[model samples]
Target: MNGSEVQFWSFVTAALLMIIGIYAIIFMDNIIKKIIGVMLIGDGVNLVLITEGFKPGGIVPIISEKLYNQSPGIFQEFADQASYSLPFALVLTNIVIGASTLAVLLGITIKLYQHYNSLSVHEIFKEEKI
Candidate 1:
């Protein structure tokens, strides 16, 4: 309900997601599951970053007419109430990179499945000659 409560919940949710992702990665035997875990981890990190930049009673960091006309030196004061844009930008970049990474991992997984006729990492490694 309040700012601190929201931040606390956001952090809790992010930590839960990251924990699930790590559990999947460490305990799941399927290559696909591992890939999904990696994606979950990425998403959790993005969530945390976005939430970290959240501001209570904040507005977008845009120079609106109201802000511009407030005072000659109002920009500095307005900045205090503006949510940071860097986290959002970083999240966007992270999403793009995560997508690319997932694509590559899926491609590799597909090839591995084709060669091994299975998606289980344990099985694949067991079949490896060397």
Candidate 2:
């Protein structure tokens, strides 16, 4: 497939992931499943960011002084071919943040499980007092 086709499919996949995540969050009774749903949504967002940064047959965004000196006109060409760095950078930062957030969420889940002896949201919150 061509670049556009691939990008379009990637977007479709990302949307599917997010939708499934939402479904799990709303319909699943298990707290762990809900947490996994949130993780799925984050992964979908990451996929989209990566897709947005992708360029067909792209090169790394790097330029050497010697290479630039050899060809003054190559800068524009390089710029055109170089996939965006911002999206990738954002995805990286998001991954780190997401991991930390997931850790905290799981930690909370463990405490809730211990207190209630159940992973079900309804069971944990049925009292609605804690």
Candidate 3:
């Protein structure tokens, strides 16, 4: 398909992921499931950001010798042809942060499970109320 169609599908997929994540976070009782939902939401957001920066027939924002040898005004052409790199960089940063956050969250969940002997949010809350 074309670039626009690809972008549309990417956005649709991201939206679906986010929706499913939200549903899981709200409806699921298990801590691990909720963590998975949070990870899904983060992934959906990253996907959307990455897709937003995508361009059809776009090249990296770097000058190459081949491009320079092709034309005298290669710099201008390169600038025009290059896709936005910021979103990709941001996504990378987000991925790292998300992974760390997930690790920390899982650690906390493990600790909670050790103390409570259960992973269910309902059970934990019910115990806390007593």
Count of steric clashes across candidates, in order: 0, 0, 0
Candidate 2 local Cα displacement, residue 98, angstroms: 0.5
- Give the local distance difference test score of model 2: 0.95
Instruction: State the lDDT of candidate 3 residue by residue for 1-130, as single tens digits.
Output: 9999999999999999999999999999999999999999999999999899999889988777886888869888778989999999999999999999999999999999999999999987884643
Off by over 4 Å in 3: 64-70
Q: Rank the candidates by lDDT, best first.
A: 2, 3, 1
Q: Evaluated with lDDT, which candidate comes out highest?
A: 2
> Model 3 misses residue 5 by how many Å?
0.5
Give the alpha carbon lDDT tens digit for every residue of 1-130 in model 2: 9999999999999999999999999999999999999999999999999999999889999899999999999999998899888999999999999999999999999998888899999988887864
Q: In model 3, what are the clashing residue pairs, if there are any?
A: none
On TM-score, the stronger of 1 and 2 is 2
Prediction 1 global C-alpha lDDT: 0.91
Best by TM-score: 2
- Weakest ten-residue segment in model 2 by summed lDDT: 121-130
Clashes of 2: 0
Candidates 1 and 2 compared: the better one by lDDT is: 2
